[model samples]
Target chain A: MNAVIFNGPRKIDVEKRPKPTLRDPTDAIVKVTSAGICGSELHMYRGHQKTATGHIMGHEFVGFIEEVGSDVRSFQVGQKVVCTFSPVCMCCWFCEHGYSNRCPEGLAPFGTQGLAGGQAEYVRVPFADGTLKSTPEGVDDELLIMMCDIFPTGHYGAMRAIECFRSSDLVNGNHYTDLDSPKRSGLSKSQSLEEAVFVCLGCGPVGLCAILTARSKGVRTIYVVDSVDDRLDQAAKLGGIPLKLGRDDVQAKVMKATQGRGADAVIEVVGNNAALRSAFDLLRPCGVLSSIGFHQGDLPFTALECYQKNLNINLGRAPVRTVFDEAMEVVAANKEKLASMVTHRLPLSKAAYGYEIFEKQLARKVILVP
Target chain B: MNAVIFNGPRKIDVEKRPKPTLRDPTDAIVKVTSAGICGSELHMYRGHQKTATGHIMGHEFVGFIEEVGSDVRSFQVGQKVVCTFSPVCMCCWFCEHGYSNRCPEGLAPFGTQGLAGGQAEYVRVPFADGTLKSTPEGVDDELLIMMCDIFPTGHYGAMRAIECFRSSDLVNGNHYTDLDSPKRSGLSKSQSLEEAVFVCLGCGPVGLCAILTARSKGVRTIYVVDSVDDRLDQAAKLGGIPLKLGRDDVQAKVMKATQGRGADAVIEVVGNNAALRSAFDLLRPCGVLSSIGFHQGDLPFTALECYQKNLNINLGRAPVRTVFDEAMEVVAANKEKLASMVTHRLPLSKAAYGYEIFEKQLARKVILVP
Candidate 1:
C-alpha cells in the first residue's frame, strides 16, 4: 500500500508500506475512501511536535470496513463508515462520563503512534464498535470525511462558547430549571445566535468550519481572522466578515462593530499565545473563550485578567462523539455550503503535494482519496 | 472622625479624619457598627499591593444608616445594613448580567479610591440602594460581618467549583433542562456534596468559612489543607480532615484518601503558583479548579495540562451581591457554628493593633467595633 509518512522536519513522502491488518478482535480493517490533512498534522511536519521518521500521518478518514474483529458486534464487512480521531471504548470511565476524548484505552486516530495512516489503501481501527459510525446513506465522501474531525470539532468549540454564555445567563436569572431540557443544546430557540457576535481566530479549516457551523446555527455576525489572504477570502465568500491578521486591528475592528463592546463569544482555533490573548481581549465582560486549538505550553492570559473580566475559560480536547450525530445533521442539511470548503483534492499517492500546499496555507482543505 | 489609614508599607495607624457626608444623591452615610480585617488586606499591609499612604482601609463592614441621600429611597436613617466589598450601581451591564463584581462604576468598599474606610466613625457608601443590603432582623454583627466578605466569598468559591463541575456534567449528559430549576443552584439535590470529596486549599477565615458552608450543604468528606497548625486545628475543630501543608504529601494524602481518584472539586483560596499547582494536582480528570484567590500573574499550568485533564477553570471576582441574600440565610441558620470563627474583637480605635495581630497570623479573624 502507498502511504504518507513523516520523513523529517518540513518533509513528507508517499512511499510503499505494508498494509494494515486486524490486530485485535475489537479492531476493523478499513479500506480508505478519503482522508484529511489536519492543521495539527502541520505541527509535526514543521518539527513543532515530535514525530519519528517513517511515521504514518493523518487522523481524519472516511472508509469502508474491509474486515471486522469478532468482538466488534456493531460493524461488519463492506460498510461505509467515518471514525473520530480518538478511538474510545464506550464503557470506559471517561467515556461513560461523556469524556471520550480522554478515554483510558483511547488510541490516536489512524496515523500517529505507530498506527498506519488512513491516507493509504487500508488502515486498522480499534474499538470499532464505539469509534466508527456508519456513514449515513447518500452522504458525499467530502461531508463524511468532515465528520471524522473538523466539523464536529468546530461544532464542539462553538457549542462550548454558547453554552458558557448560557451558563452565565442562568447565573444571572431564576431560570435554573431551563438547564434540564435537552432543547437547551448549544443555541436555544429563545436565545437566537443571530443576536450574538462570534469571532473566529485563525481561518484554517477548523476555523472556517467553525464559521460555517456558527452560520448554520443562526449566528449573523461572524468575524474571521487569519494571516493568509486566500483563507480570509474564502471566509468572506462564506458569509463571514474577513479581517486580515496583521493588517486589520482585529480588537479595534471588533470593538467598533460591537459599539465599543467586545464580541459575545470567541472561538480560539489557533492555539498560540497571541491568538489566545486576542480572544481574551475580544470578549465582553463575562464572555466565554472556547479554546479548540492544540496548545503546547502555558495559557497566555494571567489569572488576574481572567478574573477581572469575569471570563469562563474552558480548555480540553473536543469529545467529537458527543456532537457527531448533530453535526452530521447540520452537514447533511447544508451539504452544498460545506462542500465548498474542500478546495483541493488528490489521489493518495499525491499526499506529499497536499502536505506542501496545505502547510503553506495555500488551500482551505486538502482531501486525499485512496 | 477616626479611621485606620495605610500609613506606608508595614504601617497602619488610627488617625483623625473628616467624617464623611452624602457625596451624591445615591449616597448614604453609614455609621459603621463593625468591620472585619480580611486576608486580602494583609496583602496591602505587607506591601504586596500598592496602597497610598493616606488611603483608608477596610472593605467588610456592617453599619447603621446615619444619613441617606435624597435619591436613596430604600432606607431611612437608623436602618441597619451591610455592604459588599465592591459598591456596584446594579444598573451597569456587568451588574445586570449578574457580574456585579466587575461593575464598571464599582468602587473599592470602604477605602481605596477616596472611599472612606468602614473602620471609621462614618463611611459614605455610593450606590446605596444597590450595594447596601438591609440587615435581617436578629442577625448578630458577627454573622452579618461575615456576609460582608469572607462568608459570601467562600461560598462563591465553593459555588464556582460546584457550578463548573455541574456545567461540565451538562456538557457530558442530556440534562440541559436541569439548568432551569432553581434547585440546580450550586449543589444540585441529585448531585449531592455528600457524595463528592471537596478540598479547600487554604485555612484562612475565608477557607474555614468555605468548609463550614460545604458541611452545612451536606458535604461529608471535606479536606482542609493549610500550613499553619493553629488554622489547621481550627479546621479540624470545624469537622474537617486537616492536612498540614509541608508536613503531609498533600496530593498523595488526598489520592490515598480517595482511593487514588483525587478530589472532585478544589476551592483555591491561596492565590499563588505553588498553591495553584497543588490544587491542580489534587483534582482527578474532568475536575473543576475554582479560584477565589486574588492571583497576580499567569496561571502556572500549561494549556496542554488543562486540556489533557479536561479541566474547567472558572476565574473571577466573587459576585457577592448575587449570593449575599442566600448567604444571609445560611449564616442565620448556622450562626453559632460560624461565630466561632471570629477569634478576636477590638474597638475601632484599636484597629492598628488588630491589623498588627491579624497580619502576623496570630488571629483567625479580628472584628473591629465602632
Candidate 2:
C-alpha cells in the first residue's frame, strides 16, 4: 500500500506501507477511496506540532469497508463510509452528548511513530460502531470524502456559530448587531440562512465548503479572506466576496456591507489567538467566534472586549459525528457541482505530490485516490 | 439627623445632615433602623473605589419605611424593610431577568463625593418597587440585615460552586476515572461530613456567611480561612472549620479532609485574581469555584484547565434577586440564633466609629442604628 509519510520539516514522501487490519472486535478495516491532504498535514510534516517523523500523515478521508470485526453490525463488508479524524465509542457519554471529538476511546495517531493515517491505501478504524458513518447509497466518492471530516467540520462551525450568536447579548455590549439577533431576523422553523454573509479565513477546502454549507443555509454573500491570490480567485469563482488578507480591513468592509453593523457570524476555522481575536472584532456584538483551528495555547483576545460586546466564544475540535449526516444530505442534494472543492486529485502513489501541493498552498482539498 | 459622613479615605466624621425627601415619584425615604458595614465599604475606605466624599457610607441595611413614592404600593408607611445596595427599576429587563444587582439605573460608586450609599440616618431608596423588600411581619432588624446583601452572595457561591465540577475523576486522567464512568462517593448526593470543610478567606460576613450557609446546607466540614485571627474565630463560633490564612496549606488541608479529593466548592468571597486562581487550584476536579467577590482585571486561570477537568468557572456580580427569598427564609427561621453573626451596634452618630472599626477589621457586622 502506498502512503504519504512525513519525514522532516517540509518533507513528505510516497512510501510503501502494509495495509491495516481489524485490531479490535469493534474495529473495521477500510480501503481508502479518497483522502484529502490537510494543512495540518503540512504542520506535522514540518514538525511544527513536532508530531514524530515518518508518521503516516493524513487524517481526513472517505473509504469502503474492506473488512469488519466479528462484532460489527448493520455495516457490512464493502459498504461505503466516511471516518472522522479521531475514532470514538458511540456508546460513551461524550459521543452521546455530541462531544465525540473528545470521546473516551479517542484513537488517533498521537505521535510521530503513530500508525498510518487516512492518506494511505487502507486504514484501521477502531470503535467502528461509533466512528464510521456509512455514506448513503449512490453518494459519489468526492463528496463522501467531505463527510469524512472537513465538510462536517465546516458545518459544525456554522451550526455552533449560530448557537453562539443566540446566547450572548449586552455582555458583548458594543458588539451586537440585529442581522444576527435571534430576537430579530433569526432563522424561523420555515427559514434558514437564505441571504446571510459569511467571512471565512484561510480559503482551504474547509473554508470553501463552509461557503457551500453557508449557501445551503441560504447565505447569499460569502466573504473569503486569505493571503493567496489563487485562493482568492477560487473564492470569487465560488461566489464569495474575496477579501485579500492583510490588505483588507475585514471589519470595516464587513460592517460597511452590512450598513456599519457586521456579518451575521464569522467562521474562524483558523486557530490560534490572533484568528480568535479577528473573529471577535469582525462580528457584530452577539456575533459568535466559532473557532475550529487547533491551537493548544492561550487565545489573546481582550476577553473584556468579548464580554462587553457580549460576543459568544466556542472552542474544541470539530463535533463531527453529529453533523456528518446533515453534511452528506446537503452535499448529495447538490451533487453535480460540488467537486470544485477538490482541486487536486492524485493516485495513492502520488501522495507525496498531494502533500507538496498543500504545503505550497497551491491546492484546495487534494484528493488521494487509492 | 446626625450622620457619620465618609469624607474620604481616613476621613469619616460626625456631621449634621438633612433627612432625605422624596426626590422622585418612585423614591422612598427610609428611617434607617440599622445599616451594616460591608467588605465593599473597605474599597471606599481604602480609596480603591470612589464614592462621594461626606456621603453616607453603608450599602447594607434594614430600616423602617418612613415614606413611599407615589407609585409604590407594595409597602405601607412604618413597615420594616431591607434595601438592596443599588436602586433597580423592577420593570427593566435586568430586573425582570432576575439580575437586579446589575440593574441599568443603579448607581455604581467609586471615589468619595459620588451618589448616596446606605450608611446615613435617612437614606432615600429610589425605585422603591425594585430596591426594597419588606420584612415578613416581625423579622427582627439584625436578622433582616443579611437579606440586605452578603448572605445571598455567599449562597450563590455555594450553589454555583457545586454546579461547575464536570466529573470527579478527570484530574488523574486515564489513571483512574475514564470518561462516562460512574460518579464516586465524595461528590455523591448522599455524601456526609462531620462539618464540610470550607476554607473561606477574608473572614468578613460574606466568608462567615458561607461558613454558616454551608452548615445550613448540611455541609459537614466548614473550613474558613482569613488573615484576621478574630475573623477565623468568628467562623469557628458559627460551626466552621476555621483555618487561619498565612498559617496553613488550605488546599492541602482541604484535600486531606476529603481523602485527597478537594472540597466540593471553594468560594472566593475576596475578589483578587490570585484568590480566584487559588480557589480554582484547590478544587477536586469536580469541585466548583464560585466567585462572589467583585473581580477586576484579567482572571488568571486557564480556560483549558476548566475544560480538561470538566471544571465549571462562573463569574458574576452577585445576583441578589433570585436568592433573596431563600436567604430571608433562613434568617426568619433562625433569627434568635443568627444574632451571633453580628458583632457591633452603633447609633447613626457613631457611623464614623463603625467605619473605623471595620477598616481596622475589628467588626464582623457593624450596624448603624438611626
TM-score of candidate 2 to 2 decimals: 0.68
lDDT of each: 0.79, 0.65
When superposed on Cα atoms, how far off is each prediction in RMSD? 3.7, 8.6
Error of 1 at B278 (Å): 1.2
Model 2 C-alpha lDDT per residue in residues A323-359, reported as the tens digit of each score: 5656676787777656676778888788777777777
Q: Which 10 successive residues of model 2 chain B have the least lDDT summed?
A: B170-179
Top-DockQ structure, candidate number: 1
Kindly list the per-residue Cα lDDT of model 2 for residues B1-370, writing each as its tens digit. 7666777787877777787789898888888778887777777678765545767667787778888889897888898888876667767544553445445676453112445666767778877887788778876777777877787777656544432222211111211122124332221122233433455655688877666666765566667778888777777887777776778878788889877756666777887767777777776543445567766556565434433443334455555554576666656766665678778888877777777888787777888787
- Listed in order, each prediction's TM-score against the native is 0.92, 0.68
Query: Residue A104 CA error for candidate 1 (Å)?
Result: 2.3
lDDT tens digits by residue: candidate 1, A152-223: 888778777766666665433222333434232221123336778889898887887788777766688989
Q: Give the residue spans of candidate 1 off by over 4 A.
A: A107-109, A172-194, A218-220, A228-239, B173-194, B215-220, B233-240, B257-261
